[model samples]
Target: MLVAAAVCPCPPLLVPDVAAGAAPELDTARAACTDALGVLAASLPDRLLVVGPAGQSGRGPHPEGTRGSFRGFGVDLDVRLGTGNAGPAATERELPPSLAVASWLLERTGWCQAPVEGLGVGEPLAAERCIAVGREIGGRPERVALLVMGDAGACRTLKAPGYLDERAAGFDADIARALGSADVAALKALDAELAYELKVSGRAPWQVLAGAAENADLAGTLLYEDAPYGVGYVVAAWS
Candidate 1:
């Protein structure tokens, strides 16, 4: 069952090399992510599962040694899911961008408490399916810890990626509350249609988290919340 969880945004800019000089802008978010991961380590889970949005439906079982790269984002940097073997032949598939960001975070924090793996939830997946996947994850006999990575709406401001949607703020606010309070029902109830319109990519993975924590009695803390580039980025922890 899930013993702990950390919620983070999956922007490639989180990587200093990808962001270049703009890296300092996300320093606080980076720190919060590190702290959240530390909480997961404290939980001493039997394993860690990094969940994130993917281009396709249910795209992973990304093994501990799976590889990811940021070359497409203008950097040649590469990351592995855990301290497993490193090389081109380590795994058959490359992680989706969101999972790549997750891998980067784990590498940045030097995670060592448990072996790491990954699962990619499709952006448009139904809430019911997302929850079901989460339940299956929690059903594993050993204790599991999760690192959920995905961004909230991208239409918060005129300069946002989705370009100024009046409803963006409210949507992000609700998500922030649900995450901050560990409100499972709220997460599971998030409207997928509306989320798609708002450009929020975290709904499926967040619902998955809710399913895993259903009866886990986790206490949540909102570590960070912001629309730095008009995209809602949040960092939260539950333990």
Candidate 2:
């Protein structure tokens, strides 16, 4: 059953090398992520699962020790999901970009509290399916913890990735409130089509989290929320 969870934004920019000189821009977010991880560590779960958004080619399960690279982001850096002998499947399938960012955060924190694994949720995955997958995970007998990664609306400003949209701020605001309070119903009720239109990458994965915590009765804390480079990034912890 779910024991704890940490939610964070999954931008490659979270990596100092990837962000270069602008790394300082995200120092607060990074610190918040670190604190969120601390909560998971405190839970002493038997298993840790990292969940993130992915494209068609990146969807599905990634085992512990699975490899991920930031080379695609031009950093030439690599990371592993966690410490362990990677199985044949792990060796063959590389982690998606969001998962790679999670891997980077795990490495930064030196996580060793539990066996780790990853699941890449398709950005366009239906909320029902996402919730179902999460239900299965929460139903597992082992004490489980999750590190969920994805970004909110990308259109907060005129220079944002999706450009300024009048609706972006409201969407992100609702998301922040839901994550901050661990309001599973609100997360599960998120409008998928609206999220797609807003280019919100966190929608599907957040729904998965909502599903997982359905029976966990976790309490949440919002650690950070901001729109740097016009991308909505939020950090939260549930215990």
Candidate 3:
């Protein structure tokens, strides 16, 4: 597939981490994530990749809730960094465009992020510098830009309904493919009022949900409800 940008959904990419729910900034970040997910879902690509800054919660260096890899987003992927082998949870840091591409700065900067060694979020890079770094990384296919500037330390709790809704958007097509349905009714089978099965029996990964996702059988099974957000995003595609 060709590289593309869904357009910038949020501005001032780098923001301080604040408390969740009550923190306005974090809320905005969630909203941005939600918006981005919507567009990506609407596009209905065969594969989806989500890259974000993981937090190391003193459990060996990777984020607690994130999976190092997953098969659901369509194919193979390894886009996680944090505690518990996920990498260290570092503070947010902003640097100038000039410093982001500097090997010296990247080596010296305190912006610690997984995928990158010895960098912390506290040390941010200039936009131009970051772009340069991206350039240095070398281009390939599908450059989906998703800023990991959200509540640095704030906790995000997704309600059952919200999670189901997100799953519908993120995996709607996948659901359709699995069910062999031509309509969007498969994902609509999820019910907000049902109990959440955050875990599946005999699963190695604790966070992996087994039966949580609703069945894709489109035979008049429509337990899921439309999102309360009621907001549709622009599905602009670019090369």
Best by TM-score: 2
Candidates' TM-scores? Answer: 0.97, 0.99, 0.25
Per residue, candidate 3 scores C-alpha lDDT tens digits across 28-114 of 433443453344344444332221222232122222223322222232423322222432332222221111211111122321332
- Span of 10 residues, lowest total lDDT, candidate 2: 84-93
lDDT of 2 by residue, 1-239 (tens): 99999999999999999999999999999999999999999999999999999988789999998999999988889999999888888998889999999999999999999999999999999999999999999999999999999899999999999999999999999999999999999999999999999999999999999989999999999999999899899999999
**Per-residue lDDT tens digits of candidate 1, residues 71-151?**
989899998888877556456788889989998899888888888888988888899999999999888889999999989
lDDT of 3 at 111: 19
User: What shift in Å separates residue 168 of candidate 2 from its native position after superposition?
Assistant: 0.6
Off by over 4 Å in 3: 1-32, 43-122, 126-128, 136-138, 143-147, 150-239
Decoy 1 TM-score against native: 0.97
**Candidate achieving higher lDDT, 1 or 2:** 2
Tell me the spans in candidate 2 whose CA falls farther than 4 Å from its real position. none
